[model samples]
Target: MKPAAILEAALYVDDLAEAERFYGQVLGLDLLAKAEGRHVFFRCGDTVLLLFDPKATEVPPEAGARLPVPPHGAHGPGHLCFSAGAAEIELWKKHLEDHNVAIEADFEWPRGGRSIYFRDPSGNSLEFAEPRIWSFT
Candidate 1:
């Protein structure tokens, strides 16, 4: 069977608290959970965004019989794209700027839609796009 959809996306960050505030307060995502010195999770629509501590998560869990899937982590910055409505594009730009977030790039897709790219506090690239930009949508 094919996988249904992406349930989660992860990015490693140097500071968990800063990431939490940026995602929760600035981006307006709901904070899901946080493990001190380990990770912070946020709810982005139906998907969960995980901000992990590279130093903590890079070390694989001890050989255990508990978890079926071992913990995995990545290094450096990661990227994530979020979907927004056509009507919300302008509002999103204003909101981001109001929060002092710099918009690195803005583009109108030839297919039909628009996207705004920016970076998180940890330097991970993040994008917001109108759903119609992608062919699958």
Candidate 2:
């Protein structure tokens, strides 16, 4: 199947300290930026997971931003979900388990769908899934 639009996204956190503890310390997301209580950005490969609190600091819009910008970025539980294959999924699970990260749920959906769910310190539900492939009847 051809690629469509953005399948992944990110969210802001109420507490940067807590977010860093989970997403960085636990989940192993590389800390892209750490500006005190402002926010801590994580670089998840091509995508990004942001932990910003409005009470923190304000980042003014860049008139000539290089990357494609989001229209309405400052909002609620941004919901950044990632998709992976079987091998990658297993590896990620093992890594998270090794770090003592709690698993919210792990199940195989109807028709071969597979997924695992977990949350960061800020309590945002994060999931990694594999879509089921079905043949025509």
TM-score for all predictions? 0.91, 0.65
**Candidate 1 lDDT tens digits, 34-96:** 989999999988899989998887666767646444567777778888898777878888999
Which pairs clash inside model 2?
A: 9-80
Q: Per-residue CA lDDT of candidate 2, range 1-137, in tens?
A: 97775533457678778888788776678987777866688888777776777554345547887743434335454555567787878888988888777777888877785688887665677887874423244
lDDT (Cα atoms) of all candidates against the true structure: 0.88, 0.70
TM-score of 1: 0.91
True lDDT of residue 32, candidate 2: 79
Which is the leading candidate under TM-score? 1
* CA error at residue 18 for candidate 1, angstroms: 0.2
User: In angstroms, how far off is 126's CA in candidate 2?
Assistant: 0.6
Q: Give the top-scoring candidate (lDDT).
A: 1
